[model samples]
Target: MNLETTSSWFLMAAFVLYCAAFIGFVLAVTGRRWADRSPEQHQRKWGWVSFGISAAGFGAHLAFFFTRWAAAGRIPTSNMFEFMTFLAMMTTAAFLIIYALYRSPVLGAFAMPVGFVLLAYAAVFPQEISPLIPALQSHWLMIHVTTAAAGEAFFAVGFAAGLMYLLRVVNFKPTTSGGRAQVFFVELTIFTVLAIVGFVGTVFTFKGAGYEAVFLQEKSSVDQKGQLTTTEETVTYTMPPIVKPYNSEMVRMTPFLGMKEPLFETPSWMNGVNAGRKLNTVVWSLLTAAIMYAALRLILRKPIGAAIQPALDGMDPEDLDEISYRAIAIGFPVFSLGGLVFAMIWAHKAWGRFWGWDPKETWAFITWLFYTIYLHLRLSRGWLGRRSAWMAVIGFVVVMFTLVGVNLVIAGLHSYAGV
Candidate 1:
């Protein structure tokens, strides 16, 4: 088999191993009180077993990365599919390092799913190894992207630990107003994650069903020579169109559940083909998330947060809080080097400017500043425990928005990364 095909098999193997390891970690944390074995021994034995499996998975993931790099004749971090896989791998690597220091089964249980979801999310995009555009053909592609992803992986680890900390400590019933607000925010965070997972499932479901919608749009662009060029482009959607491309004509659409056409045209302000598709995707994702959340609520007959709180019963809130803080602390400098410093240098090299206030650049700086505040507040302003954990959680949201949302909502020089 070709290296490209071999690399895909390796990635599939890594994903399967990660899933199995997540189950093992969950058992390690949640099944410790079982009568079959001593709690300490069960925890210790399964923790090692899970860690070993996760490490093997990481090795397989590394093989996938290297083989893909060799097949593509460039670093694989040049596009969405490649970057997400790398990010997932780095997240697992970060979890392994953190687990070695603390031997925390709960961390593995939480962190492993983050990698799993990311790897799955990567699959949503096309996996073909296309040649990089001129803008991305630089040594800096590997240096800047990989380091930034490694650092963000730690932040993702921190988010997992912080989420566990909240699950351990937050009151489920929440009689008081403040307690109710805390419960709301925590549940909101969980729902957001569900939405992303739902988004992936929704995409694949329609894709597998061979759903198709086509729109023809006219695009106007100004060339470097200051001439206006008009072109007709065909945009296709795998999902049923809730909104068609702005100012575009429908070429064809297969009926879905008796819906023969789009509900409306996307607003003129949201003119790009990608923007319309993205907005429609957001609508479908939220709907799917609601259905999934309702199903879970009905099955459990309780709030999701309350159901998860039981697994975290014996875990210490303070330890989780500390782990979250330390993970971010370690990632901060690495992010500084990759997300800010090296990024600026590469931007200068590529665009002949260090900073252009592009959407991605602005968001990257904002992410750095947000983390900077997290560190400062924890160190100088006595924001530890619950407060610190909340910051870690919110910081992760900022990081994700920087990574994903900017591309979805805005167009700029970094638009290529979104594709």
Candidate 2:
């Protein structure tokens, strides 16, 4: 059928399927809890039901993506929304594989919500039906972007597991019941809750108090007319020393500040878009700060009692730590080969350079370095278990910067992937 018709249908189907998968994950967590008190038959029944629902949801999600690609007559990684969908699919697939191997439904309980949030974020932006730009019209576009997305998906899972390990280790004690599993579950819950709160707050702040403007200032300079005069010059005019806007309110709030002044402006066509995004960022930052403060207060209220109780019983700390390390071992190579090596190859072919210090490229290198150090620490420094888990957490933070922070905060060749 028509592109619009097909795209709309696919978007709707993807949303419904993701919601279904999220519910299935929640049910699976509930079933795991019930396994302790309920009959074996009931536990197995719910487990099977949960698996089937997730499987079906994942199938629908894949179909929606492939159909969109077919309708567009090209690969679907040209923009932020499509990239999000692709990443969500890859993450779900990876989570399912891990679940199959380890038989840990708890991973799904954490991963599905993250996938859902990303898909929902994708839906917030309008999907444009346009031909790929010449730079992205090559086959490597598919290979490079898809592989990078897969690597990102794996890192996302690693992040979830590492966070779980951290919570378990920090609250360690020798006598509490289900302490291991409880710590894992609590960590997942706290991460999910904070993410949601942060996202919502960002949406509200950007919607309420965001502004867009193009600032200009007078500078001491000689014009082309050959007479020296202080006159209004466009921000792009750099030969006579850049003009600096004097309004403190504007200077303080401008998002593209350099050492001397703001270097970019929100063009008329993009003013609303930039303002909205800025507002979202501010709101999310405030919300995150608030959640962190509240969590600290709650933790301090009964510090020893609260911390020592949940980590008393459950899985072995060493086992959890080992799992975290193993997951990173599997993901790190993929990230290096896909996000770095292949990306450079594509850049060389498309831009006549192997490396250009693009923001995306820089962040990718940072992520690679972060994980390389993690591996080194584990192998050479005799760091394992808790220390290794902490490294994995930090590595994932670097991965996040590579995947999201660079795209959002820095402008470069990969700007197309930001909304």
Candidate 3:
């Protein structure tokens, strides 16, 4: 098989292995053991198994990546799909490193699921191989984007550990530290993760199903003779419909949901067929995830975090908190080098200026600022424990917004998002 086909098979196999690792990790933690005594031998044994399997999966993930790199003739970080997979890979590699340091099996239990969800999130994007765009055809694409993504992956580890700290330290009931907001975000994070899972399932289940709709784009032009002429362009998607013509006179060729008029028209620049379809897919994904979440809550009769708290009893809240901090400390400078410094170098090469305050660059600044403040608060201001953990969580959210949100919502030179 060609490298592309072989890498795809490896990717599929890695995902399957990750699923097994998640299950094994969950089983290791929640296996029937007495709370009064220390963790059972079987629990620890299973934890090793989970780590080994996850490591094996990471091997396949790396193989998939290198194979794709070989096939593409560049590092596979130019697009959202490739960047995301790299994020998953980095997160897993970071988790393994942390595991080596802390030897906390349950931490793997925590971090691996986030990695799994990241892979799922990556799957939501188009996976076909394509030629690199002009701006991305540089060695810096590897140096810049991959380093930034790797840094974000460490933050993902912080997120997992920070989540564990919350589960261990925070109370769902009212507290002086604005506990209600914490409770809500904690729950939202759970939903978001499950939402990612729901999105992957929804997307993949319909693979090979050539479902599509079309929208019309019209341009009115004035000739040198002062006569006006209008031309129409057709856009199609295998995904759901999102944007439509603003003019009431122009209707959708495919009347999705039986609505002739759209809720609002997309701005001409932001109205690319693929972009609009991706947005619509996002809406469907959230709706699907919401339904799944509701059904899950109905069956469980309690918040998922509360349910998982019991299994987390053996893990130290302080250690979890510290690991989150260490992850950021290690990742921040690398993030600065890759996400900011190298990016500025590329910007100078590509745009003839260091910065234009474009949405992606702006958000990258915001992300860096958030983490910088996090370090400032921790080091200079003596902010530690729950507050630090919360900052860690918020920082990763900023990172996420930079990674995907900018591409989805904002239009700019770098907003192509690997498609």
- Best-performing candidate as measured by lDDT: 1
Q: Per-residue lDDT tens digits of candidate 2, residues 1-419? A: 87557766766765676667666655655555446556445534554565666666677777777778888888888887788878877877777766666655445555666676777666645577678877887888888888878877777777666655666556544356666554554444455446654654454454445533343444454689998876553322111112223321132333423434443433222222133244344444555756764786586664332442342235466655666666677777777888888889999999999999988888888888888888898889999876677676667667655666665455578776665
TM-score leaderboard ranking: 1, 3, 2
Model 3 stretches astray by more than 4 angstroms:
32-40, 173-177, 219-233, 242-275
Worst 10 residues of 2 by lDDT: 235-244
Among these predictions, the greatest TM-score belongs to 1
Quote the lDDT for 261 in model 3: 41
lDDT of 1 by residue, 156-232 (tens): 99999999999889998989999999999998989998998999899999999998999997777899999999988
The segments of candidate 2 whose C-alpha lies over 4 angstroms from its true place after superposition are 1-4, 30-45, 172-197, 200-276, 288-313
Error of 1 at 138 (Å): 1.1
Clash number for every model? Answer: 0, 5, 1
lDDT per model vs. reference: 0.91, 0.63, 0.79
Residue clash pairs of candidate 2: 176-312, 176-313, 179-313, 202-284, 206-279
